[model samples]
Target: MEQASEMGEIGREARHEGGKDEEFRVQPKWRKFLAHVGPGALVAIGFLDPSNLETDMQAGADYKYQLLWVILVGMVFALLIQTLAANLGVKTGKHLAELCREEYPRFVNICLWIIAELAVISDDIPEVLGTAFAFNILLKIPVWAGVILTVFSTLLLLGVQRFGARKLEFIIAAFMFTMAACFFGELSYLRPSAGEVVKGMFVPRLQGKGAAANAIALFGAIITPYNLFLHSALVLSRKTPRSVKSIRAACRYFLIECSLAFVVAFLINVAVVVVAGSICNAGNLSPDDANTCSDLTLQSTPLLLRNVLGRSSSVVYAVALLASGQSTTISCTFAGQVIMQGFLDMRMKNWVRNLITRVIAIAPSLIVSVVSGPSGAGKLIIFSSMVLSFELPFALIPLLKFCNSSKKVGPLKESIYTVVIAWMLSFALIVVNTYFLVWTYVDWLVHNHLPKYANALVSIVVFALMAAYLVFVVYLTFRRDAVATYVPVSERAQAQAEDGTGAQAVAAAAAADHPAPFRKDLADASM
Candidate 1:
């Protein structure tokens, strides 16, 4: 009777503490939504990075409205893949990179890590160059000087993150809002045909000379690989409950937040394309304006807008570009940290990691900016996007394989319908990227003036690399899940089992030999 009374007192104490916690928590719809807002916004910034801007501008200026459908399709694929990534982190208490470490052999793990790191650098190049472009336009600084400045600026932003992820997220969200306003305002001012925009979004077409190539660029820009790793890791920052019901609720909330973020990103992309298309297709362009449209690079994009929206509009463009570049650079740095820590089991200070990545990314931008100038830097962005395209399958195939396996994710494994659709999307991306590679190579081979022997040697090496890439992808797709039979134990149960005497302790010791789900608090606190 005494023991029962003590238990009742303990239970009442718990209820009282919970009640106090509830009182302090955010109430109603908007406050709760804001709490779940950070990770999705970070992921969404990848979609609006400078790489996307250059490609979107090119698409609009060159093909008018023929490739909007690719953006729509790519974003839908992004939503599906990002949702899986978030769920993986939430359920396993491990990010994608950590999971890869545990699931693959050391050698394979190293290869995956190298590939992921390359993807991070590939994603960073455009951001670094884009920020330099912004500084050049806004401050009248040289692009090379701007490149040097971006390294320090990104370091400063990483310092801001020491305060809290939420603070940095708020700043990024503000940048996104600023970009949206600038592009949408431009879209409203120079009203493109609503019907044509709608048709471009729904009706699929790739008829123009470079239309197919731009369509591939659009896919690369929207559906990035490191974004999957970054999203999975970012979800660990939120304090989610461990109960199945609570987990489901958190997943739903994340999905809703991600959907909203993607919607905003999609609208921003559409606005960019529309603004470029409307200005270039106006039929009343001056010679200089027409020439600007003919070579519609990022440097000339703002000038094109100035011709239509006045010189003041250039400031708006520069500010928006600056915001895009800075926000995405912050995200890329965070992703680099996550990838390095998760893959190698080595952790470093954020500033140190950011500095290393920034330096590596800046070298190429600085050289290209100084040597080849702004035009070369713009081409570098396009080339970086293509590199991302080539690297996508390496990251994606592993993600899909793990997410579908029962052992790795247990009951959290994706549904058959989801798995089927995801693989189909993966297949489509692979096909498109492969086609782009082959077509570009074949066209080069046909047009180049190189000697026959030299061309043959080059072709042989290119084909060999392609063959190796395909073989690696196939291996990732079919490799067995290393932890396919592992089961997770709750912390409370694990503690109790370990504390018990004799046989219980023996069983718990044996269970400990197997891989265990990471501690939720530890994972949440680390980020």
Candidate 2:
């Protein structure tokens, strides 16, 4: 009886310990999720950058809330494309840049590097202008002086990464929230019709003049090119284990975190549009405010919030714009580093690299600001947006091809539904961009100040380049992935090991003919 009683006690202890174990398991699931949160936050900042603000403000001031649907669609597509990048990193232990280097020849790689660098520089133009405009608004500095100041300010922000990527993410995220709070606070005051905002977000319409162009710009701002390289490389910083369950779990957690981050970004974008729409279209709008709305730019966005924030409007708007511009500058710098390191296998200190890109980006901005002042600077932002739109296909085509490659991701290739959706969205983007480019070029040709001979020569060169662009995109789309970087050896070995099969034999066979190494470290590994 004593032995029986002891056994019952033992059973009770076992049950209690089991309960504790279950609780422990459930608790760390969330903790593990927290570990995956920083990368998505970093990527989501790209969505709320100054470029996005420029497009959002224009869309709202010009068409009220009619273009909110564009933001929704663009963000949905951005989420899909970004997750594919993360999946590529997690599954292959390599970022998109590294993969591109391995897959392309030396000449092709050089061309791609130049194209990506141009994309980086073009992206920085708006950040430079937007941040400068913020400084001018707040400190009452000349726009040209403010443009020069942007060169030094971003270097200080980049210093945060010295602590760690997570710390930098925290800093960027804080800036993002600051911008959100400022806009949403203004939004509450304006109180645009909730029904109209809902309809604008769900129902797609491009009724008014220039609405189509604004929609294109809005879409381009949201889906940035450098963001793909940044997201893919950022995932490598997490050090996920090389196991099926761990990889799958990491991908799932990253997606959820990314979705949440985008939701915050989307709301912030909506608030910007709604506030601009509400104030610009108000019956009580002053003539000066009406004139500003008739031609809204970042420099004048503060006027929209004048009645709401009163004398503090410029200060509040400048603060939000500064956060928007500076946060994106930091993100752009990080992306430039990743692009250089990934494609050219070249690495530099963050400040040095940032200074180089910033200097290049500053020249055009300074010239426009000094020559034509704030209006010219605003037009430069739109020009930069168009450049980004044109550059998107180069980065995107390769990513789509890589993600759909069975050899590149082995058993982790994207699903049929995902593939179909990705292609459809991509095709739409390419068509819109091509049509716009051709239309703009023809429009310029028809109304140009150039000599006819010079116009003829320019037209030939431009058409040739456009043709080359389309051909290259077609090549990448149909290109066969000749290399297998992420084989199914790990999965196969784990399965076979349970039945006494040797894992080494499987790894050996998988690695035998592989040109690229199976494991790639972000710091030292070369493709």
Candidate 3:
């Protein structure tokens, strides 16, 4: 009886203490619907980035829109996956990353931290560059200064979350409008063959050098790793009633919202491809368009829009780019916090988290920009995705285990069909990524000028390391996890109310040291 009272106090304190907030609240019925639509907008913005643009551009210019079907297929997968993210948050009252921290082994958690952190930084570079380039195009601010300006402005805005999450969502919403307007403007002006556009959307084909890579880029952009973390966490920002039915409704609404948003996003992605294909595939083409076709950057996007569309296209395009960058930056910051808190249960200031990411992202970016200009920076984004591809196994394998288990999410969560599809998708992703890694390694070995002996030795070492990594990933896939043994809602309420007394100690100790700083984020297979 005494222990039960102590548990009750602990629950109450956890609920009340710290800056930790209850889920977000919508004012009226209409507001809930409106708010339901928010995350997908931000999510779409993440994929509409310059890097993703380049992929769409390359795919279209080289393959002439044959690979456009990837957008539709990819979004289908994305909708399913993102809904799972939202459901996790709603069902567990915890973010995916936090759940990961709780469920995964220490070494695995540490590795996940490093990889996830890297993915954020890599994702941020394009955001920084895209925004910086936009400022230069629209306002004549130099790229470097513009980057600093972007980091500063975003940080300032983040500082004002005191106002509320809804307000931040509003700003991001405006940015979404801007992105939509810019793409539509470009689309209208280019006036590409509509029949062909539809055909492209439905068709699947690839040809020529690096076409496969471009397709992967499109997929990677659309179904980004960090966006999963962000989406799952963002749902928590909503104040859904702590009832199963209410949470289920909220989940369903979010699914619809994300679907609509992703469709719009899919359209924008198609618009970008069509615009680039139109501009670059110009038979009487200008030198600039042809050359830029091979490699489209943020600066090139606006110019292409202007030439293809009307004069206002550049302004519209730049505005969209700015929105893309800012939205991504905000989302990245959120995910970073999720990672920190989820794994370690640490809660640093938002500025601190953002700063850490910006510093890590900018340092390598600055070095590359100074040494090799934009291309070097661009390569960093690609390599970062590659790293994300490597790190995906850790996050995904564990997430799959959790949702599939009766313990963590309970049996009522995902359906059997959903589980099967997720695994199928996961398998395809791993194969594609792993295959590419091997191909790149072999190609590197063939091209490098090192002595045969040295080359052989290096190749062996690289092969061994990759083998180990793959083994670990495969191991996670085949293993079973002890689920969280989730409690019923009534029991949950009881637990929370009985769990308050040690709140400070719990929160503070969890804050002191990251529980899995250098670990691999691997879950315990048995439990």
Candidate 4:
């Protein structure tokens, strides 16, 4: 342990001095195993985004215990997929975005980056709006003021990462645990029927029109495109030794860590639903809550908590909401950095990136907040999800392809069965999400949901935006980059036995024997 520590310090100082003082040697034993613990915490908090609160709240309110299964499915897959990402990152020195850039072509890379940036901006919009809503409810601050405040608050958090990624993880993890405690306390107080909770979790049923949408929202929150990119890249922050045994151990522990995170996320979801359901399902809902029951917003939830769960519960709920939004902001900033660096190979200071992203995100947020303060938060969430829906194919399609590729991901390659099933599922999800987005946008375009008749000018502008969005989707589905050809391992083995890399003369040769195919396949690779 002392040797590894000394070696790390030596390596750092030597690098700092431009190799002038080379003293440290490579590690005798890799410390990569220690890195698996932090990335899961980051990914876990991804589930707690404010958008998720709405979905979880809806799930519990409408169905009571029936949709606990959403959380179950979410956690199960989050662990399964994130471990794959962590394993890939630890095995390969590069992060997922870097791999994508190395794997795909220029135009394709830029397209993906644009999509990811949009998703990040979309994700940030909610955090901005949610913070505003919380400010409005608790402090009676104007929503516009809250928006400005959130950007500054997040800018301050940008400094926290200066110490290290693990520092950011610990801070975020503490907040997540605090959120869990608050909800778990609520769950205990509510004492929701255990049998019903179990039944809801195990049995999958969509009873109302809202059921399907709520289920979709829950699934969308759990398996987000940004989180996938975020997880893969985050695993690369720590240096892990690349060896068979150590890689395998890292993979195993990551699985455990991710599974645990997912389960905790599940309980939090259950708590949200339980809290909402208890109030909505109460024998005596007040007329105002009952009247607005069909359309609950962030503003509605705390009041419900205060009435049903007590004023203390309301305080806990708001505090947790603040923690949830802030922790999510931490990751949103980190993910933005990875996307920018991976796609562009440009490194900016954390604060610069945070300021740049928050500035862009805050404008649309400010306009919406000022024009439609408290009520607009819900629209902001739906719009964010819609943006995520549009960006889904960019991230999801690449991950599916890369995970299944033998040459790129190696023995860690997803099984043929896993590939087929995962691809089918991913394609179905993208289609469904896209369909919803298109429908929503189209409905807005045609009806103009504003009071009185539609303004032709506004409708025309919306049409243009929606058309551009559709064009982007069509490009993703139909676009083809230069596909890299792969020589099978068996063929490579036969070649090696014959004359590949002049096998007898070369002590280590696979890296040399490998073709330039990964370079050829590079167009679609950016994260």
Candidate 5:
């Protein structure tokens, strides 16, 4: 009777295991896709930030559809780089910054961290300004006051974490969809030439003044550096499966989700350019409207929209701007947390981290808004975007190196075709951005009517910085991958032994290393 009871228990356990496997296999495709949605949407926010909006507006108003091809190119590159970032996290169980910490020398890692932090701050400046601008429009508050308000508002957004990361992602996704609807509605109203839009996307051309600068700005604004960090880290939040088939499925789902998100972003951007180009370039524009188009600032963009979508459209524009700023700021906050913790191996409460980032970002924004007023704040947004343009190579080069390294990723390293294409894209971006950097500085030196001695001194300093920048890029490009190449056979044997013993020893060692429950809690909560 005892033996029969044991046989019955074993049969039930086998049926349960089979059912679990069957359930996994038969899970609906849509549900799987939905599970992988948040990270892509979060990363997509960077592509639609206020900086990108400003550049898109300027591109359309200035060159009509001539620079649309740049947007296409930028999105394609963004998709490629972001996929690599996602793959790195899923395969290695480590984010990019952590890998950098493990791989690079101490000093080099420190420098990289500083650069990454700078990129974060630089990215934040535009969001701060945009949020402030939204407040200036919506509440009749001064830009300086709005800048102060942004700090608190961001904290409130970060507060959504108590609910869950998915809550925050959902809120941001709603904002993105809202923005897209507004732009698409405006696009339908204005009826920009579909032919011109198509030509602009496919046929590469850069005509007229400021086209090159605007193109570089578009590239920078679209394919952000910090978003790479954010994407790799964000994927860690999802509980992806460990089996090879399951990993591949998760990757494909993520790629589809990211592609879809970026496609939405790409279209919204195109719509912005289209709406601006069509409305501002109309034959019936008033003299004031024409002048506004000639010098399109964020403040003037709504006024231009008012001409087509009626006066009420400005409020809609402001609402969308608010959404853009708030959503992107939240994503930036997460990126900041990931970057600090990964690079430093130190953790902080999310609120504390957000406050620190906001304070640093707010100081300059507050000063600029107060000193120069709204117009000055607008110019600051453009300047901040330019800073992002220059910082791209610093981040991109390292990402390409890590993703392509067979030793680092082992069997999961990218294919040769992917490696070659990625490097080519990286090289092209470096060359174009470098050229833009050199030419813009030279152009300023030539055009500025400063005293020769003072001008010469400034020029010397600028060129020296440029030289240093090139040297650093070269260093990153050729840097050795120092991450552990192989685990010794003995170590593997010992690990297998520990696993055979049920991993109690491994768990104890981990507990010893991370003794504080609060620290582990903080890290887990943040992830």
Candidate 6:
């Protein structure tokens, strides 16, 4: 009777403390949700980056609403993969890069690090060139001068990180919305046929000479390699409550937030395509505008939009492009910092890291801008897209492998349904990307004006490298992970049952660390 009274007294105390906590600590679902918002927004920037904008414009101008389906499908795949990345980080308390370093051998880690660095550099090129193009349009500066200006401009914007990640995310989200407003405003004016846009989104068709190529480029641009790294690392910034329910809630909130971000990106991309299509397909198009549509580039988009936006069209387009470029550049820089720290376990100052990446990205852009002009810069964006296509498998395969491994995520390992769907989709994407890579290489080999011997030599060297690439990919896929970072709850419970003293010790330790309510809950759970 005395023991029962003591237990009842303890229960009453917990209930009283819980009542007080509810008055002060109960938060609306939205309030709790706001904490997990930044990472998804940051990851979404990659989808709206300049390279994506370029692809969207070309799809509309070239194929005229026939490819909106690609963006929809691509975004779905992106959301799935991105959610897995967030879950991995939240459950393991380690980002993808750190996990990769721990999971792979030293030589493999070094190689992966180099590939990741190259991927970042390639991704940054389009952003650099796009910002330069925006500058040339707005300030009447030469593309080379604009390229130089991006160095300083991006660094200044990145200074917001000194305040906090949330500040930077807010700033970038604002810029993304600004870009959306500009495109949607244009979309409102152009008003492409609703039926046609709807049909394009639902029906999958590739009907032209370059339509298949464009579709591949669109997919490659959306599912970026560094983004997987960025998303995983970004979630680590948020401190989730250390409990299964809290962790699962955090992952769900992130998935929702990420879905919303992708929707905005999807709408903006659709707007870009429709705006380009509506203008290009208009019966009233002039001969020069017709020519521009035939070969639409970012530099010519302002001219194309002049029909609606008129006089200040260039200014509006420049502002939108600048926002896209700057926001993406900032995110890429952040991803670089994360990648460096994770792969090599090295941490450099933000400015120093940004400077190194910016310099490497700039050298090629500056040279191309000076020697061959805007056209050269455009070609550089294409090159970067191809590089990303090749790098995607490396980052993506490992993410899948790690997430499916019990040792990595423990009790949070993704379900069999998710695993099956993810791998199938991943396989399809890999096949598409592989086709694009080989096609591009073969097309280059076929078209190059070289002697037979030179062509033969080039083919041998390129094909040899391709063979090595395949071997590396297969190796990463088949290699089993031996490290166990997270212990499953089931195993812990079994351990506790096997040793009552250990269980008591663990419960006592957890109680000491947790609050009264949590302690009571934990005690009940142990019982």
Residue 7 error, candidate 2, Å:
49
Compose the digit string of candidate 1's lDDT tens values, residues 1-527.
Answer: 99888766654543342332233233665665665676886788778888999988888888898889998998999899999998887777788888888888888889888888888887888888888888888899898898999987887776776678566656666765776676777777787888999999999999978787788778878877888888888887766533344456567888999999899889889888888888888898889888878777777767545544477766766767777787777777668778888889887776788778878888888899999998888878877887887788877887888887778767767789998999998998888888888998999999999999999999999999989888888888888886764365455433433333233333333332322233443344322
lDDT of each: 0.77, 0.79, 0.68, 0.65, 0.76, 0.78
Q: Please, what is the TM-score per model?
A: 0.86, 0.87, 0.83, 0.77, 0.86, 0.86
Shift of residue 395 alpha carbon in model 6, Å: 0.6
Best-matching candidate per TM-score: 2
Segments in model 4 whose C-alpha atoms lie over 4 Å from true places: 1-35, 62-67, 160-172, 194-196, 291-294, 304-309, 437-527
**Which scores better on lDDT, 1 or 4?**
1
Off by over 4 Å in 2: 1-27, 159-172, 490-492, 496-527
**lDDT by residue for model 4 over 1-527, one digit each (tens)?**
99888766644532332221111112222333343466786787778878787667767767777778877876666566676676666555456677678777788789889888888887877777777777776777788898888877777766665557466656556765765666666667767677877888888787865566677767766766777777776665543323333445556667777777777777777788877777678777778777666567765676545534475654555656676787787777778877888889987766778788889988988998789766676767755764575566677666666666665656656667766766676667666766665666666676666644455666677678767766765664554533443333244433433332333222122222322111212221111
lDDT of 1 at 496: 38
TM-score, cand. 2 vs. native: 0.87
lDDT of 6 at 304: 52
Q: Across residues 421-519, which tens digit of lDDT does each residue of candidate 6 receive?
A: 888987887677667668878898878899999999988998898888888888998999988777543344334323333433333333322222122
Model 5 poorest 10 in a row by lDDT: 512-521
Model 6, stretches more than 4 Å misplaced? 1-26, 159-172, 489-507, 511-527
Total clashing pairs in model 3: 35
lDDT of 1 at 462: 98
Candidate 5: count of backbone clashes, pairs at least 3 residues apart or interchain: 0
Roughly what TM-score does model 4 have, to 2 decimal places? 0.77
Residue-by-residue lDDT tens digits, candidate 5, 443-491: 8988999999999899899889889899999999998887663222234
Error of 2 at 99 (Å): 0.5
